[model samples]
Structures are given as C-alpha cells and as structure tokens.
Target: LFGYVLILVLVTFDYKELAPLGYILYGIVILLLIYTGLFVHTIAGTQRWINLGFFHLQPSEPAKLAVVIVLASYYSNHDTEDGYRLRDIIRPAILTAVPFVLIMMQPDLGTALMLGILFVSMTLFVKLRWSTISILGTVAMGGAFIGWKFLLKDYQRRRIETFLNPEGDPMNHGYQIMQSKIAVGSGQVFGKGFLEGTQGHLHFLPERHTDFAFSVWAEEWGFVGSVFFLGCYFFLLLWGINIAMTARDKFGVLLAFGLVMLIFWQAVINLFMIMGFLPVVGIPLPLFSYGGSSLLTTLISIGILMNIRMRRYQIKT
Candidate 1:
C-alpha cells in the first residue's frame, strides 16, 4: 500500500525538476551511508541501517536512486556524437565510486555491486570508442580478481567456496542453498497450493519471508505459477526498456534504463542464488521480497518511469 501510494505521488511530478538536485541528493545519501556505517548498531552482523524507531532505514537502498539520477543529470547535459575519450568517464566513475566505497564500508556487498553495475550499465548506453571499452573491461576484470582475493571477508569467501561444493559444508555455509534446491524441486508442476507448501509453512526455509521470498512463492505456486510470475517480471523489464528508448531526452533515457537495470540485476541475482547457480548474496527481489527499503526504492523507480512516460510528448531535443 505504501508502494502504491509512492507511485501515485511521484507520477504526478515532472522528472525534469529533479535534474538540478541530483548531485545534492547524491551527496546527502553518501553522508547517510557514512553515518549508518560508523554509528548505527550492527544488526545480523552488519551495520547497514539507521534505527528510526518505527522502522530501520537502509541508506544504501536509496543511494541507488541518488546515483542513477546524478549520473543521468550529467550525461543528459553533456554528450558527444562521436565516441568519448577514456578520460571523459572519470567524473562519473568518481561520482559512482564515492557511494560504492561508503556502502562497501557498511560491508553490504549486494548494494555495492548494484551501484557498480548501475554505473557500468548506464555507461554502456553511451557511445564509447572501442579502445576505451576494451581498457575499462580489462580493468573491471582485474578489480573483480582483487576484490575476491583480498577484499572479501572470510565468511564471504566461504559463501562462494560453498557454492562451488555444497556437500563440503552441508550444515553450515551450504545449508541454505541445499534447502532452497529441495524446496524448488519439491514444487514439481502445479505446486502444493497457496500456504500449503511444507518447506515454507513448516519453517524449513530460512529467510523465507525476506531474501528467499521467491522460494516461498515457488514452493507454493509450483513451476507453472513460477513461470507466470517470471513472465510478468520479463514484461515489466521489456516495457521499461521500451519507455527508455522512447524517452524524449537523454536524461529520461538514462534515468529510465538505469532504474530498470537496478531492479533487473537484483531479481536475476536473487533468483540465481536461490536456485544454486550463484552464491547467495542478500539481494532482495523487488516487490516480491519483504523489505521496506527495497520496496520503496522500487516503487519510486516505477514512479519515475511513469513520469517519463507521461511527459514523452514534451521532447527536449
């Protein structure tokens, strides 16, 4: 209901109004992330949220929006017909890296990855010289290697190691993935019916209401229903992509596409993690997962998409 209300409220505003405030908003989120990381009490082994009495607020979630808007604001105003020089992206990279570093300090790997991906996705849309793309790609690969080898914490590395060999640690790191697979396999075709899933109802699936919400959904809905749900997600992505393509200005295009990618990768990673194809990262599935911060950010992104769609007739170009 709050999500719906957010969409209704934001859709009525002009997206263009946000252009000037992008950097300011981005800076504000950065400060919030720093405060959360340093001062907020740790919960479940991480200090990722601020205690707001009624509800804990996760600053990193909204940082996704801040980064997207600020990047779009920069790109829309200054663009080149020919491919950009490699040096041109430094500003945007720095803009993205600030929040990335802050969130990483919170030790929230999932949101940090999302920010990095958001930057890369938005950059890809811009026409870049082949040499520049090659250099950046190589740099990205090297960064990943260094991140895995030195930056990842002991438990984080164990998660990936366990993903490779689940049988090695069935009772510890590997437990969740193994159980997730069983639940998925148990939901053969038509499912066991709503609220009747043994895995979820029996409380056998850990984090069933949050990170593994899809597992609960699949265990109850079966393969057919799972397919239907996934199809809807696919349609939403395609629809948002179409909106990005048809957007009147470059900012709208970037904003719409960036927001969609933000939601897209989260869903993809969550589903793959649940199915044992990837290591479990605590990324929540948009709308489907029970998280106040994620749901609010997702709805705001949807609202921005609607804002872009409604104002398409007012082409800036």
Candidate 2:
C-alpha cells in the first residue's frame, strides 16, 4: 500500500535532512492553511482540506507533524541543561501560535488543540522552568475561555455542551456520543464478534469510520479486543520512546520524541472522546480511522522513528 511505500522512502534517507527543511515545510503548511480558509469551499462544514484530485489533502493533519518537526529542530539546536526559560520559549511559542491561529480560523478545534498539545509536549521534553510552566498554564486557561466564547463554532459549542449533559439533547447534538457509549458498552467482555456490531450494522453511529471509528471497532471486538487494540498502540508508542532515548544525536532524540507525542495525543483524545470522557473534538484514531491523511501522517511519523532508530549508530562515521 501507499503507507508502506511512504515509510520505505522516508527511511531510505537520513531524517536529519529534515532539520533544515522544518521551517520551510512549516511555512508552506501555514500558507496552505491560509489558502484553505480563503478559497477552499467547506466540505462537511470545515474548510480543512484541499482538492488534490485523487485525495482531499487536509492541511491540519500535516500541520500537526509540522509543529513536531519545527519544535524538535528548534529544541535540538537551542537546548540547555538548565531547561528553557521564559525568554527562550518565545520564538517557539510564536511558531506554534501562527498555525494555531490559522487553523483555528478554519474552526477545526481538534487540530488546533493538537497543535497546542504538540508545543507543550515537545517543550516539556526539553524541560521547562516552573516559572515558565506556571505562566503558560495561566495563559492556556485564559486562551480556553477566549476560544469558548468567540472562536468555537456553534456546533463545536454544542459538542462541548453535549459532553457535559448528553441526555439534555439526546436527539440532536448528543446523538453521536450517546450512540458511541452504547456501542462501547454493548461490546461487554468479549465483543459481538467481528462485523457483527449492532450500532454500526444498524447505521446508528455517525462518523463510524472517522471520528467514531473506535466505537464501531469496540462494538465488534468487545472489551478484550479493545484492550488488545490499545495494547498494539502501547507497544508502538513505547518503541518510539525507546528510540528517542537511544538515538545518537540531539536532533534524532527530539524528532523521535516529538513524533511519538503526536501519535500519543491523537490516539488518547480519540479514545477518550468515544468513551464519553472528553467532548468529541474530531480527532481520528490514528491508523484505525478512515482517513487518507491521518493514516499517512501516522505512517510517516512511525517511519521517521524507524529512520532514527536505524541510523542511531551510524552518526559516528
């Protein structure tokens, strides 16, 4: 498949080659985000994709990876043992904010939220002063208030409200979450057997293959299967983290860690959303979700992790 081919091509070259191009790619994605907002028509009520003929390329999907690379490259170059200070983080903050603002304008809260988490993840990896953490935490709360008030779309607000009280609007905004909970709970201990799930088979679950992909999966596979499914991701993430710890260079370390965090947050958010612990933010369940862009992004990120692992020792010669 194309995913296999992308990983193959990505590992054939040194991932360090990406260091110089991080900002370039980030800039291009930022432009694409702006272009999507200005010219692209809304598909499914979101201007987050481009008509790439064969595929509708979602800029926000790649935008997450872009932030990872940019932050990794920046941190690798400017690292200090004492940890990052207030002044040290300003540029990285701006780099993160640019795409955050642009994508938020498209009003894709999920992707925008991912970007913020990406920045925090990478920044924490390098370590942050308590002063910096407190400052950022306060700012984040303020920003959330602003986002809720003026930035979130009506439907997005409804999703949050529905998260708080699904029964309050069970037929309207609450339908997705309610159905998701049922599908997951009905799976019981072992599941309904593969492709035998009632919720998805009866067509009651919307976005069954996208945002709610895990719900359909859980319905079919049951609790045991769900744990087994998550176990796979657990190993994949741990492998990535091991690679980051073992990588020979600072760039390789940061790159591997940032990419792993990218996968981590997406998977966690999607899982929590489906289980009713978090509002539906439209985050795909990584490789499981039926999305060309999300799948490829996850694949390429894993490839980069492999690339770092493969050449972790070759840097000396």
Candidate 3:
C-alpha cells in the first residue's frame, strides 16, 4: 500500500535533511490554504480542498505536518534550560497563528484548534516557568471564551449549542448527536453484531461511514469492542511518546511529540463528538474514517514518527 511505502521512504530518509526546508514547506502550505480559499472548489459552504484531476487535496491536512516541522525546527534550535520568557514565544506563536488564522478562514475550526493545541503542547515540554504557565493558561482560557463569543461563525456556534442541548434542535443541527447517542446506547453491553446495527443499517444514523464511523462501530462492536479500540489508541500514543523520550536530538523529540499530539488530539475530539460530549467539528477518526486526506495525513505523520525512531542513534564515524 502507499502508506507502507511512504513510511519506508521516510524511515530511511534523514530528518535533518528536511529541517532546513521546514519554513519552505510551511510557506507552501500557507499558500495552498490561501489558494484554496480564493480559487479551489467550494463544496456545500466550505473551501478546504484543491482539485488535482485525480483527487481533491485538502491543504489543511498537509498544513498539519508543515506546522509540526516548522515548530520543531524552531524549538530545537532555540531551546533554553530555564524555559522561555513571555517575549521568547513571539515568533513561534506567529508561526502557529499564521496558519491558525488562515485555516480558520476556511472555517475549519477543528484543525485550527489542533494547531493551537499543538503549539501549547510543544511549549509545555520547552521547560517554561510555573508562573509563566499559570499566566499563559489563564490567558488561553480567557481567549477561548472570547473566541467562542465573537470569532466563531454562526454554524460553529450552533454546533456547540447543539452539543449542549441536542433536544433543542432535534430535527436540524442536533439530529446527528441525538441519533449518535441512540445508536451508541442501543448497543448496550454486547452490541448487535456486524451488519446488524439497526441505527446505521437502517439509515437512522447520519454520516455513518464518515464522521459517525464510531457510532456505527460501537453499535456493532459493543462496549467491549469499543474499549478494545480505545486501548489500541492508548498503546499507539504511548509508543509515540516512547519514541519522543528516546530520540537522539531535540528536533527528533519535538517532531515526534508534535505528530503524536496531532493524531491524539484529533482522535480524542472526534470520539467526544460522536458521544455527544463535544460539538461535531468534522474531525475524522484517523485511520477508521473514510477520507483520503485524513488517512494520508495520518500516514505521513506515521512515516515521520518511524523516521525519527529509526534514526534515534548516532551514525558511526
């Protein structure tokens, strides 16, 4: 498969060689985001992809990798033992915010939040002072409140509202969450078995094969199977974190950490969305969701992870 080949190629490739081109790739993705907004095909109400004759490419997918490499490269080169000062985070903040703003303009709140979380997650490992962390944390919470009140578009706000009270708009915005909850609960402890889930099989569940893949999966697999799937994800995260801890250089450490959070956070959010605990923000369930861009992005991140793990040792002179 192409995924296997990508991991093979990146594993053998030197990560350092990609280091210098980090900003270049970042810039290219930024351009792609802008181009996508201005000229790419717009479906429904979002402009988030480019038509390439064969397949539509979502710029935000690659933008995730670009942000990781750019931030890792910057952090590895500029790290301090005592951690960063308030003034020290400006450039990295800009690096993250630029894409954050651009992607948000496409109204891709899910990916934008991922970028914001990526920056915060990486900064936590950068050894900042406790006082600084407290101040930043407070500011971040306040900023989130403000963004929710003012910056989020109409539908975005409605999604959050719907999550809070699915009954409020049962026939419209809340339909997905309401149906999802029913399907998940219907499975109870033992599930209804494969191809036997009434909610999904009978079409009561929306987006059954895509955003609601978890709903269908849970309906068929039951509580035990759902727990097993989550256990696998837990191990996957642990594996990436292990690689980050043992990486030979700062770049390798940050790169692996960023990629892990990228997958980890997206999966967490998507899971929460399906359970009606969070708003449906259109985040795919990584490898499980039926999406080309989401699958490819995950594969690329895995490739980078394997690349870091493979080169975690010094070469013999």
Candidate 4:
C-alpha cells in the first residue's frame, strides 16, 4: 500500500526535476549510511539499518537509487559520442566506491555488491571503449583474487564453501540453502497448495518470511506459479527497457535502464542463492521478498520508471 502510494505521488511530477537533486540525494544517503554503520545497533547480526521507531530505515537500499540518479546525472551531462575511457569513469567509480566501502564495512555484502553491479551496468550501457574494457577486466580479476584472499571474513568464506558442498556442513552454514532447495524441488509440477508447504509453515526453512519468501511461494504454488511470477518480472524488465529506449533525453534513458538493471540482478541473485546455485548473500528478491526497505526502494525505482515513460512527450530542456 505504501509502495503504491509512493508511485502515485511520484508520477505526478516531471522526472526531470530529480536530475538536479541527484547529488543532494546521494550526499544525504551517504551520511545516513555512515551513521547507521557507525552508531546503529546490529539487528540479526548487521548494522545496516537505523532505528526510527516504527521504521528501520536502511539507507543502503536507497543508496542504490541514489547511485542510479547521480550516475545518470553525471553520465548524461558528459555523454560522449564514442564511449567512456578509463579516466572518463574515474569520477563515477569514486562516487560508487564511497558507498560501496561504507556498505561493505557494515558487512552487508549484498548491498555493496548491488552498488558495484549498478556501476558496471550503467557504465557498460554508456559503452566503454575496448581498451578501457580490457583494463577493467584485468582489474576485476585482480580484485576478486584479493577480496577472496584478504578481505573475506570467515563466515563469508563459509558461504562459498557451503555452495559447493552443502552436505559438508548440513547442520550449520549449509542448512538454509539445503532446505531452500528441498522446498523448491518438493513443489514439483503442482506444488503443495496454499499454506500447505511444511518447509515454511512448519519452520523447516529458515528466513522463510524474509530472504526465502520465494521458496515458500514456490513450494506452495509449484512450477506453474513460479513460472508465472518470473514471467511477470521478465515483462517488467522489458517495459523498463522500452521506456529507456523511448525516453526523450539521455538522463531518462540512463535512469530507466540503470533502475531496470538494479531490479534484474537482485532477482537473479536471490533466486539463484535460494536454489543453491549461488552462495547465500542475503539479497532479498525484489517485490517477492518481505522487506520494507527493499520494497520501498524498488517501488520508487518503478515510480521513476513510470515517471520517465509518462513524460516522454515533454520537450527536452
């Protein structure tokens, strides 16, 4: 309901109004994230949210949106006919790194990873030169090596280990993925029916109401339901692409596409993580997963997407 309300409210304005305020939003979110990381008490083992009485404001979620807007503003302002070189992306990379490191310090790998993905998606959308791509590819390979060797905590390392061999630690680190896979397989062709899946209702699956929400739904609704739900997500991405292609200006195009990639990667990572194909990184499935912060950010992205589509007829300023 709140998501719907936000959408209704935002589409009333010209999305162009948001362009000028991009850096302002980015700065505010960065400060909020720093406060949350430094002072907020950890809930469920991570200090990713600020306690605001009735609402736990997770600034990292909105940081995703902020990065999209700010990067769009930067890219649109300095768009080149050819592509971005290594030096060309330094500012955006630095803009992204500040939030990425803050979120990483929160040990919230999921959101940090999301910020990195958003940066890559938007930069690629702008078309990087071949020489720049080669440099980035090498740097990414080196970064991955260093991250695994030096930066990953013990539990973070365990996730990757569990992904490869869940049975090795069936009663511990591997438990959630094992149960999630079972829930999905149990659904089969026709599922166990509404409110009937034992894995979820019986507490066999951990985090069923939050990270594993899709598992519960899949278990109850079966293959047909899963396909239908995924199909809807597929269409949403397509619509976002259509909006970007038809948008009147570069900022709108970048904003719409960046927002779509944000949703796209989250959904893919969550589904794969739950199904045991990828390590569990605590990424909530967009819209499907039960999270106020995640839902709000996603809806805002959708609202902005609609705003861009709605104002397609406006003259470019």
Candidate 5:
C-alpha cells in the first residue's frame, strides 16, 4: 500500500518517471517470478532471476512467505515426540534451503543472510534444544566461513574488507560509504533542507534513490526527520509484536514474530551499513527505497501482517 502510493507520488510530481521503461520492467519481473519456481535447475550463479531486458525480479522475496507458511502449517499439524525431533528440524531446514540456495545464486548475500536469520529465529521459536542449536550454529558459521573463502566472488569479499577499512579505498569500493557518512554527518542536529543536499544532488552518494535513500533523508531532514522516520518503524514493529502476542495459535505467533524480525533486522542492518557503523551489505531501507520489486515485496509483507491481524481476532468456532 505504502509502496504503491509512494511510487504514484513520485510519478505525480515528476520526481522519478518509470513509464518509459515500465513495460520492460514489468515484463522482466514477471519472467523472473516464473523462472524461479519452474526452472530452478537451469538457474546458474544466482538463485534470483532471469533478467529479461527490462527489470529484474526476485522470486526469493515471495519465497520467504512461502517458507513461513509451509513451516507454520507443518508445525500446526505435527506433534513432537521429545521437544522437536531431528525430522522436525530437517523439514523446515530443507524448506529454507531451497530458497536460500536460489537467492545465494543471485549473489545477493544480503537477502540470503536475512533468510538465514529468519530461519534461525523461527527454529528457535519452535523450541529446539540447546545442544541442537549449538551444533547448528557451529555448522552454519563454518559453512559461512567456507562460503566466504571459496564461494563468494572477489567483489563481495572486497565489500567486507572495505567496510573494515573504507578510508583505504576512497575512490573505489569505499566511495559510497564515505559519501554516505559525509551526507549523514553534514545533517548534524537539524539538516541542510529538503532537496538541498549537496551530496545527493551532486550524485556523490551512489544509489541515492535506492539503497542509500536514508542518506538523502538524513542530508535533508537531519536528525529530527530521521528520528521521525524511525519512530514510524518503531510503531510498526511494536504493533506487529503485539499482534503476535495476542495470536490464538502458536503458528500465527511464530509467523508474525518471524516476519517482524525480518523487517526490523533488515532496517537495523541497512541503517547501520549506510551510517558506516557496519559493512555495506546492500540492504535497502524498507518503504523508503526506490526499487519497485523491493517496494512491492515489503508492501505485500505488510498486507500479510494485516491479514493475520484481522483474522486473528475471529474465533474459528
């Protein structure tokens, strides 16, 4: 809802026009969605999508909801012999792996990492034993390390290394982070004023309309506006948590919690990355970024939350 509205606003004000390439963009998004499920075998390198000249769509985005629904449905029907058996864990793990493997192929390390976090959070909520958690954690960490060393592309490694020492590569990989910091720092307490940001207007900050949208806000609105934006997110998070707490079933609660965590954690990680507090992970600020795919996915996720909330109050009996 918010995404569609924001896009309309952008188009209305002529702030950003999409009509010229809208058809191509929509065509690609549709193709990517179809390919992700039907042609998983043919998908190479990244599990994201097949670019069709116009736009690139990520099926993994919706796959997140599918995994949640499938996992929730399974748990809703099944009973554990002792806490949660190995099979119980394996089923959900397999469900998560299908999409995780696909998205990782896109080489979208950020979304893949988010999916990993979602899996861990949901599994923990399922009441896995400490021993199992420990074993899984160790294995996951080791696999990640191996992936970093062997599977990750050269540029990806540079992102991590650059995050650690951004100043070392001011003109290359670090340029985005450095410019982001300058934009944020320049805002100080108040801000430079809307559409008046030198960094943003001058194109010094890369992805200004997308991943680094927050920097545009910070550079213009300053600390006050930034806090306001965060407050809205805070409201959304708290409301989602409240919905989970009052949910009639464990499945509803876990699904709501998992979704909330997904959004909240993404926001935190993205903001931290843009602020130079963490490595640049290419995670976009939800609702505020310009990508149509991301915007639509986030809105649909919120719609799912609304559906859960509305239905949660009705007694099945």
Candidate 6:
C-alpha cells in the first residue's frame, strides 16, 4: 500500500511526464538509471542510486517488485503439471533479463546479483525440473561469462579484480571493506556505545547511514545489538514465510515467497557484506538504512504481504 502510494507520488511528481504514456515507464526508469550511473551517483565508480534534492531513490528497488509481480502473475496462471517447459523458463528468462541488464548497465553488480538470486529461487519454487533448471543454469552461466568478457564496463571488472585481492588495494578499492572490518572488530561484544564509534565519527566508514548502517549499529550497540537486529530480521523472515505458506492461492503464495526472498536474501547479504564476510556489492540494510526509496519500497512490499494476509480468510460469496 505504502509502496504503491510512493510509486504514485513518484509517478505523479518525478515521472509525471512519462506516467501518462505508461508504456514508457520502463524506458524512463532504465534511462534514469543509466544517467545516474554515468553521472549522478558514481561513487566508487558504480552507478546505483540517484540523488534527488529531497531523496535518494534507487530505481532498482522498484525494479525488483516489478520483476516479482510479472513472475508471480505468470506462474499463478500457467499450468506446470509436466514440469517447466522450455517456454515457461523462457518467459521468466526474458522477464528477469530486462531488469538484470538495466541494473548491470548501472554497474550495480550487487543488486543485479540479487535479481539473479531472485530468479533462481522463484523458478525453483515454481517446481521447474532439475534437468530444465540445469540446462537453463548452464546457459545463464555462459551468458554471464560472455557479459563479463564483453559487456562489463572497466570499473566493474576492477571491482571483481579488487574483490579477488583486497589486500592489493587496501587504500583504494578495498578501503571500505577493510575499514568496515575494523569497525566491527572494534565493537568488542558490547560495542563502543552509541555515537561514540571512532570509525563512524571520524568518517572512516563510507555511507555509514546507508549501505554501512549495520556497521554503525554494530559499533554503537556491539555484538549484543547485532544479535538483536538479526533476531528482528529472523522474526520478519519467519513471519513472511508463514504468510507464504498460508496464502489462499498460488498467486498469493508466489507473491509472498518472492517478497520473502527479496527481503531475506538482501538482509543476509547486506549484513554479511558489512561484517567483511562478503564483498561490498553495495546492498542496503533495509528499514534501518537511511534511504527513502528503500524504506518506501520495503514498507510497500509489507503492505502487499498484508493485503494478501488480510484477504486470506475472506472468500468471495
């Protein structure tokens, strides 16, 4: 509900000119994402978010929902008794490709990777056959290799290279990851106490209130706070999974599952990235992060979950 409202407002304001065309929404989004990547939010040489005076919006955030809706709607109506046919996989392949390409074009390797994860999870949930999945997986891998060899922009390649050897560029490409580790280690169980974190206060951590926000919490609240935060995430995931299981229909079920995967995968990945357990792909920490776009999109997704839950018991007369 809130997500829809926010989308409405975004369309009403920033995208007003394109809203009436409807057909152009996707193009507009892609174009703006490209523009931001090339010019607006080129920090660390990856273009993901766009800074509007009032808010920093991530076009990829809504793109995730869009992909989920298209997939859920298709799977809900299709028959899969004989297992997923090539055509069934093709439909979703195309669905996942557009956003994946656009986001990758933004050079947001992390979010793009998340989209790939979403695709695989949703496809598996739809009961696509192992043989079919294997064939498709191989092709996808081949395509990714081709993209890496031919499609990836230079900086993106560099990010991968740096990930392979963080120590090779500790003061440059690896600084964020290295500093993040230091901050987490410095917390020492109970944390340095709120607002007293030297790393964050001294600005040693980049994007502290956004992508690295978990580090901020960990620094201030320490290991105990980290556990509590993880607990909240655990509760949320369980709650969403419960909703998925109890959904009244296949559409509701798939929709809930997609939402669950989106939230769960992203939360786990972001947390891990900040803890130096994973590469810095620049995924955000959801509600606790300071991005309006992410917060709005997350709340809206919850609204969709609520919508499914509320109507679960109300059969039509």
Q: What TM-score, computed on C-alpha atoms, does each candidate reach?
A: 0.97, 0.97, 0.95, 0.97, 0.83, 0.85
In lDDT terms, how accurate is model 1?
Answer: 0.89
The digit string of per-residue lDDT tens for model 4 on 194-290 reads 9999999999999998889999999999999999999999999999999999999999999999999999999999999999988998899998788
Model 2: per-residue Cα lDDT over 50-115, one tens digit each = 988988899988888888998888888997888889999999999999999998888789999999
lDDT of 5 at 154: 84
Model 6 RMSD, rounded to 1 decimal? 4.9
Q: Model 3: how far is 142 from its true place, Å?
A: 4.1
Candidate 5, residues 131-194, lDDT tens digits: the string is 7877798989998898898767788899999999999999999999999999998998889998
lDDT head-to-head 1 vs 2, winner? 2
Compose the digit string of candidate 3's lDDT tens values, residues 58-121. Answer: 8898888898888899888987888788778879889999989888888899888889989999
Per-residue lDDT of candidate 6, residues 52-91 (tens digit):
7777788888777777766777787785788997777787
Model 5, residue 240: distance off in Å is 0.5
Model 4 lDDT at residue 231: 98
Q: Lowest summed-lDDT stretch of 10 residues in model 4?
A: 42-51
Q: Which pairs of residues collide in model 4?
A: none
Task: Report residue 33 deviation for candidate 6 (angstroms).
Answer: 5.1
Cα lDDT, model 5, residue 295:
69
Instruction: Point out the higher-scoring one by lDDT: 5 or 6.
Output: 6
Q: Candidate 6: list runs displaced more than 4 Å.
A: 1-56
**Considering TM-score, which of the candidate structures 1 and 3 is the better prediction for this target?**
1
lDDT to native, each model: 0.89, 0.91, 0.89, 0.92, 0.74, 0.78
Q: How much is 292 displaced in model 4, in angstroms? A: 0.7
TM-score of 2: 0.97
Sort the candidates on lDDT, descending order: 4, 2, 1, 3, 6, 5
